[model samples]
Target: MKNTLSRLKYLYRKASRAGADYYNAPYRAAIARARREEDDLFMLLVFSEMMGIPNPAGWYCMELQPLMLERFHDWHTRMGMERSPLDNFRCC
Candidate 1:
């Protein structure tokens, strides 16, 4: 796992363009892992990437980021989590 993340970091640094090489492959895995850990960071990365938002980490950055994020949120809500952050962070 450490090597995987290290490889990702190396690739990220070696990458030329920003949005062009958003995610390779392991980065996607890292994002999925990250999602299981936290909702805010995961959603933020997914939403930002799907909307073409620039992210240096390139972690939650894939063409299907939007769909995955939606599914993740749905699953989370179904599991009894709140979704009030969409309207206002303060509300949650």
Candidate 2:
């Protein structure tokens, strides 16, 4: 009886997870797009100085450069630039 109850509980949990995933499938693409846009905005904020844009939070954003540099190439390309916008930094 204990084993049967445990098995039933496991099945119930599995079914719940599957159901949730199925329900969320339609919105998955929208969620992914929104997340990507948010990241792109964050990258822009971090690299705004390099792109010739004056960043109001430049002092605070300076600390984030090293961490965000790796994604700089992708971000600039996505923004329709053929090459790195920064004269000092070239990635591509």
Candidate 3:
């Protein structure tokens, strides 16, 4: 009887996890997409000057470049670009 109860508890835990995952899948996906969009916007703000668009806050945004350096490569790749147009900070 003890063995049967333990097995039932294990099965219940497994089912609970599966149900939670199913319910949270859409929220997880939406969060991921929102993060991606936010990242893209941040990159644009930081590199607008390179793209020939004069950003009023370009000077201020420059300070964030170093912090965002690690994501530069992934950002460009996600944009489906072969290379970053900014020559000074190549992420390819």
Candidate 4:
């Protein structure tokens, strides 16, 4: 778990520097159905801190699938591998 956490830290650093966001658009449409509350904001701040970004001035369960997909795509592309849909292991 420690190794995974450390690896995640590296990925988070890379992602943050690349301007990735948990609150990106597809995420917003999924999770921001209502006004963000206090606890939600706290989680955002924590995530922001872990990713080494400025504490989000706020919080919002964010529908996380889209950004997750985007990241997979981004990584695949950057690797110069042929992009695949990652669904049932099909080609993209």
Candidate 5:
């Protein structure tokens, strides 16, 4: 009886997971696109000064440099940049 209960519980969990995935599948792509756009905007906000765009929050954004530098390469590539846009920071 215990063994059967365990098996039933496992199947119930699996089915619930499958149902959740199916329900979320349609919104996944849209969520991903929105997240990408959001990241792009964030990168722009953080690196606007280096990109020749004057940013009002430049001072505040500077604090994010250390945290964001690691993602610089991916961000620039996605933005169609062949190389880093900042003269001071080269992220190939």
Candidate 6:
């Protein structure tokens, strides 16, 4: 009887996790998409000069390029871009 009770407890925990995951799937996806969009906008701002859109803060943005380099590949992939928009800059 003790073994059976332990088994039941484990099953209950598993089921609760599964149910929570199912219910939260849409919210998780929306949040992920929103984060990706936010990252993309930040990338655009950092690389605006590459797009021929003269950025007023272009000089300040240059310093952040090295720090943002690692995320560039993943960001472009998430945006469905074939290559980095700043390919000409080659900082990534």
Candidate 1 local Cα displacement, residue 81, angstroms: 15
Model 1 lDDT, full chain set = 0.59
- C-alpha RMSD in Å of predicted model 1 compared with the true structure: 16.2
Q: What are the per-residue Cα lDDT tens digits for candidate 2 across 1-92? A: 99999999999999999999999999999998999899999988887887789999988898998898888888889889989888887888
Model 2 — TM-score against the truth? 0.78
The digit string of per-residue lDDT tens for model 4 on 1-92 reads 99999999999898886675644756775555443344344433433533456644423313443444434444445446675524443335
Candidates ranked, most accurate by TM-score first: 2, 5, 3, 6, 1, 4
Candidate 4 TM-score, C-alpha based: 0.22
Compare the candidates by lDDT and give the number of the best one.
5
User: Model 3 compared with the native: what TM-score?
Assistant: 0.68
Most accurate candidate by TM-score:
2
lDDT of 1 at 63: 57
Quote each prediction's TM-score.
0.25, 0.78, 0.68, 0.22, 0.74, 0.59
Report the CA-based lDDT of candidate 4 relative to the real structure.
0.50
Residue pair clashes in candidate 6: none
**Candidate 1 Cα misplacement greater than 4 A, ranges:** 1-37, 57-60, 63-92
State the lDDT of candidate 5 residue by residue for 1-92, as single tens digits.
99999999999999999999999999999999999899989989998888789999999999998899888899989889889888998887
Give the 10-residue window scoring lowest on summed lDDT in candidate 2.
43-52
Model 2 Cα RMSD, Å? Answer: 1.9
**How large is the C-alpha RMSD of every model relative to the true structure?**
16.2, 1.9, 4.6, 21.2, 2.6, 5.1
Badly placed stretches (over 4 Å) of model 4 are 1-66, 85-91
